[model samples]
Target: MTNTALDQALQTLERATSTPELVKATQALCALNDLEAAKPLVKVLGFNNPAVAAVATQGLIQLGRDTIPILLVSLDARNYGARAWVVKVIAALRDPRGLDLLEHALEADIAPSVRRSATRGLADLELSEDAAHDQLVRCFEGLLKAVRDDEWVVRYAAAYGLEQRLNSAAVSAHLAEQGRAALNQLASDAEGVRVVQLRALKALQRLNAG
Candidate 1:
């Protein structure tokens, strides 16, 4: 799509009411493959309507890593809703700094979802060394509780933490039963845990190379 066409689609996104129209607009923009489109798309971060925010978040994701810095900047938004979405965006980014920001948010942010995401992002990043073992243990304990959270995202993220930390055989075995259960649940159920769990499983699987 041309720049003019993409701009026209974005305008339609602004006025769109139905899901299909917004999807079409996003598809056009995504096909353009310009991450810069996500810069303006960040406005959707603050969109008053939840549905609009959801759509905008989807668009921002289609922009991929391009959205990470913008999402990180948005984490400081005064609005809790925006911050929560930014946490999700950062988790989606799952880049190196992604977990670092999450650690910062875990220590400093007030919102539960944001804190929750930070913990999960820490798991996703899988830090090395015993430097933060104290914090990791504490975070994993919290995730233990999260593994059963009514919120599926929270529950699986907790499990994902288990998946990432299996290198610490001591730590991995501590929750071995729960880890198996989570992966079992994921395989038995649908949509709750996916690649994060898979990645964690691979991490654990590799530690036995001895």
Candidate 2:
């Protein structure tokens, strides 16, 4: 798109004072998907409008790792909505740079939704074969801890994350075994929610099949 078009979209986003205005502006900005739009798209996460935020989220994800620094700098602990949406974007991007943020969110964020996204993000992290052992351990331990989270939804995401990690080529055999044990425990957890149990069981089956 032309600089003029981008400038117009940015102006629209800046002047937006209503949902429709926000949606239309965000849609225009997202359509451009210019790196210049990254900061403004991130700002939309805190607008508390799901439709507009969804458009911005897709825009940021499309922008990919180029947006991580902006997303990281934009995180405001006091803004739960923004933090949650940021976690989701980080997760979707699966950049290794997000590891620390994802782990922190999983462990410390008060919002279960943020914790859940972080859990899944940990599993989705794209690590090199040469990635540090401690980093691998950190991811494993984080997911392991999340399996016991008070929120069932977080636990469910943990199960999925553990499964993904267990299946990753980067994971050590020892860690995979540990992950299997964790999934087995979750699968047989009679007191656990049926959906979680089933998900854990399915993860175990997939691991075994591979």
**Using TM-score as the measure, which candidate wins?**
2
TM-score of each: 0.58, 0.91
Give Cα distance to truth, residue 183, candidate 2, Å.
Answer: 0.6
Per-residue CA lDDT of candidate 2, range 77-99, in tens?
78888888899999999888899
Candidate 1's error at 167, in angstroms? 5.0
For every candidate in turn, the CA RMSD to the true structure comes to 7.4, 1.8
Q: How accurate is candidate 1 locally (lDDT)?
A: 0.62
lDDT of 2 at 194: 92
Q: Which regions of candidate 2 deviate over 4 angstroms?
A: 1-4
Model-by-model lDDT, in order?
0.62, 0.88
lDDT of 1 by residue, 57-81 (tens): 7766667776677666665457777
